[model samples]
Target: MTITINTSEIPDTATEADRALKAKHAAMWASGDYPAVATDIVAALGGVLVDTLDIRAGHCVLDVAAGTGTSALPAARRGAVVTATDLTPELLDLGRASAAEHGLQLSWQVADAEALPYDDGAFDAVMSAIGVMFAPHHQQAADELLRVCRPGGRIGVLSWTPAGFIGQMFAVLKPYAPPPPPGASPAPLWGSGDHVRQLFGERVTDFVARERSLPVTRFADGAEFRDYFKRNYGPTIAVYRFIAGDPDKVAALDAELAALGDRFLAEGVMHWDYLLVTATRA
Candidate 1:
């Protein structure tokens, strides 16, 4: 269970996603009811966490890079004492609202994933759904995840499956919206989920990788999706700025999604691919 990251093709400069990750994404999440979208995404992957981590009631859980608490809320409901930590404050704002609405109480902290400001072995399990992939320094990030949990604790992570339709969507998006300046490694974390266990001494006792298509159930139309990009994608704001005040942009996007629906959508399912990673610490 050796996890060796392949970063040869990644750029030396912080790829676009690092700098503008939160601000634009928060804006998009605010524009539309992204909480509903988050709920659906979380539901699609919930069981994997339950089985893989053996998460039980009253377990102390640390969700690093916890975005919108999609996984945190479920883990809390399972009776795990959850601390949802993220780098951005505004994201915490969103996570707080979502948690309250669900009647789940989560300990929220604003902190960096690489340099966690927590006591060692503070959590029984650590999970970061779709989080570590965004780390500029993948190895450092992995080390931190392992460092915070007690001996033999569990570590579960989610990553995006690269080169699928979602990959193509991101590729198509870079031109429309270039990523902001990077902070740590200056490289975009692309194609990283393939092998990550070696970074943790191969202690991932029960490892399972899953792929699923996330259907966007609530988007009003492609225009709505495009609006979502402004908050979620690294390059959306710049792209939006370039085409700002254009009345026809929404119409053009609607047409594009309608055309894509013929091939990708079936019965209103806008398929998005993602990878779910689960492991244990030795």
Candidate 2:
């Protein structure tokens, strides 16, 4: 029996499927205790963005997908008028508490990267550290990043490269994780310089990209690294929980990830490489 699924029907179906997938993605992130894992690793990257952009005291800064204000609070400390936005209300609340602890005053908003709430040209510098790349609609997210920045203002991004350790981790987890919907771009594409150029085409100037390494974890061995991620990282935790009923699959994934960790382990630490992108709004 030949099942000739109508090709024309696929597009609409795929669109709806992708929309549902995005909602699932949001819920997954919201489910886990991400700040418990992300805080230490992301905090330093925030400082890097602030330094790279040379953000001045009077600059207006917006940190989109600003999980727990990793980059936002640092910018505020540098005296910029900063607004941090993220989809997760819990993360935003944690960011607010952190800012208060530091005695810093900054606005926080629950926002979606693809549809920013701010007016055009409202910010002098916009940044995200390992954040915005997760948006399901990459082009729309890129458009919003450019739209909110003033002409000549900077956009700084830190993304996990498709070839980097973190990227490889996702590759290793592919067999266990549910596949993304057809036509949905993978998040790691944002780490590719070519993809970034394509995404920001004609919308940016002085575009610059550099390969940077950040220490994501320190472990005595691959087993320790695997155990740490499985316990702490949100995506890792989510996947493991999802496959809990399949013990064989869970064991397989754990073993694969442990083996994958060997490539990055060096002298008791695992360093992950990422792409740092900066550009001026056109």
- TM-scores of the candidates are 0.71, 0.90
Q: Who wins the TM-score comparison?
A: 2
Cα lDDT tens digits, model 1, 1-282, are: 111222353234433564355444434434534444456444666545555687888899888878677678788888888888776666678889978998997889875676676766778899887655666566777887887887778888776555554555555445444444444432223234455655555645665566655665645455556556555443344456655667577355435534443445557566767766666666
Top candidate (lDDT): 2
Output the worst ten-in-a-row residue range by lDDT, candidate 1: 1-10
lDDT for 195 in candidate 1 is: 54
Task: Please write out the lDDT profile of model 2 over residues 145-249, one tens digit for every residue.
Answer: 998899999999989999998899888877787776665677888999999999999989999999988886556777777887787677787789879999999
Off by over 4 Å in 2: 1-23
Q: What is the C-alpha RMSD of each candidate to the true structure, in Å?
A: 7.4, 8.6
Q: What's the lDDT for candidate 1?
A: 0.63
Candidate 2: residue 35 Cα off by (Å): 1.8
The runs of at least 3 residues in candidate 1 whose Cα sits more than 4 Å from the true structure, single-residue gaps closed, are 1-36, 39-43, 46-48, 101-103, 179-192, 198-203, 219-224, 227-235, 242-263
